[model samples]
Target: MKRYRQFEPVLISGFKILEWTHPEHNHNHYEFIFIREGTGRHIVNGHSFPYKAGSIFLLGPDDQHYFEIEQLTHFVYLKFTDAYLCRNSSGSTSAIQQLEYLIKSRETHQMGFQLVGEDNAIITLIFDTLLLLRKDQIVNQELIWFQLFTVVHVLQRNMPELRSNSFKSRDLQAMFCYIHKNIYDPNRLRI
Candidate 1:
């Protein structure tokens, strides 16, 4: 019910050392949250899940969430909007659109991905590098955009495969595939 709306296109990335407190809230912008350290539970849209260091959660505008921080935590959030993604005609519109669809279609209001195993090292490295640039007030917009895009792509690629518990028939599978394939064209999807 609470919506945090920002009109301007922006990319905000930062690290926060926090107390055991997080407000329950929702936003108009998209959020990619990475837990740098500590332990807690993240509750989104009534779904509760435990979280620890390396936990990552992606949220769209429709989700409402908050955290029960059990310990002192370090949080990193990459907040952006579609306007930000399209701020420049970098020929990335289609890719961003796909990423948006992926984010929306995947698990909602829960841990989208965990920065574990090989992902731990790679994501940490990228996070650290980006944090440094941010701290220094670097003006490398292109680099920042690309790095954040990479992070989104990683999350999308790591998302769990959709489970079709309702439709077990091969016809359902074909129908689902066809729907996805024609998602971009309204006329094709209608037919």
Candidate 2:
């Protein structure tokens, strides 16, 4: 298991042209991948799924994956960590905790989203905004947060099970405390 870590509290965004250069990899952070214009088969833990323009996939920590590109693909990736999600928390049910449940409970092999019709248009609009914002090196943290939340929320709306309100408050509180207290302590992190 490769544990790629992000030290800073910021969303990592990029556009890549696929040439089958990178091997299958899994990391410690959460990944939101959008296929901007491409045709490909996404391989997750040996299972294959077809993907095209507007395809969205969420890779949580430990979701091993790689892509088999069929057409020259333009892939966009948005990566972040729980620490970043928790940075602006104000209450018990925060984005980090919502994301914790969303990420940890999902099947590693599941493709997170499929775009269609109006949904496709709307998400693509948001995707374009995020790409533009990243390109300009803008410091609009609130917009970044909202955009990421919209992505996650859209995925949840598509998957009914993901929309379940099952996280208990005490658990979120405890998890928040544990994460904040030991974020810089690797030894404590190991526990």
Give all TM-scores, in the order shown: 0.75, 0.74
Best by TM-score: 1
Model 2, total clashes: 0
Error of 2 at 145 (Å): 0.3
Candidate 2 runs further than 4 Å off = 1-3, 91-98, 105-109, 136-138, 160-191
TM-score computed on alpha carbons, candidate 2: 0.74
lDDT of 2 by residue, 1-191 (tens): 44567765656465667677667878777788888898989987667889899998888777788889999888777777768776755553565565655676555237656778887887888878888777544577778778887776665556655335344556778889998998998888785
lDDT of 1 by residue, 65-142 (tens): 888888877877777787887675478876686577667674734655675688777777777766766653347667
For candidate 2, give the lDDT. 0.73
Which candidate leads the pack in lDDT?
A: 2
Model 1 segments more than 4 A misplaced? 17-22, 136-138, 162-191
Model 2 C-alpha RMSD vs. true structure (Å) is 14.0
Q: Looking at model 1, how many pairs of residues clash?
A: 0
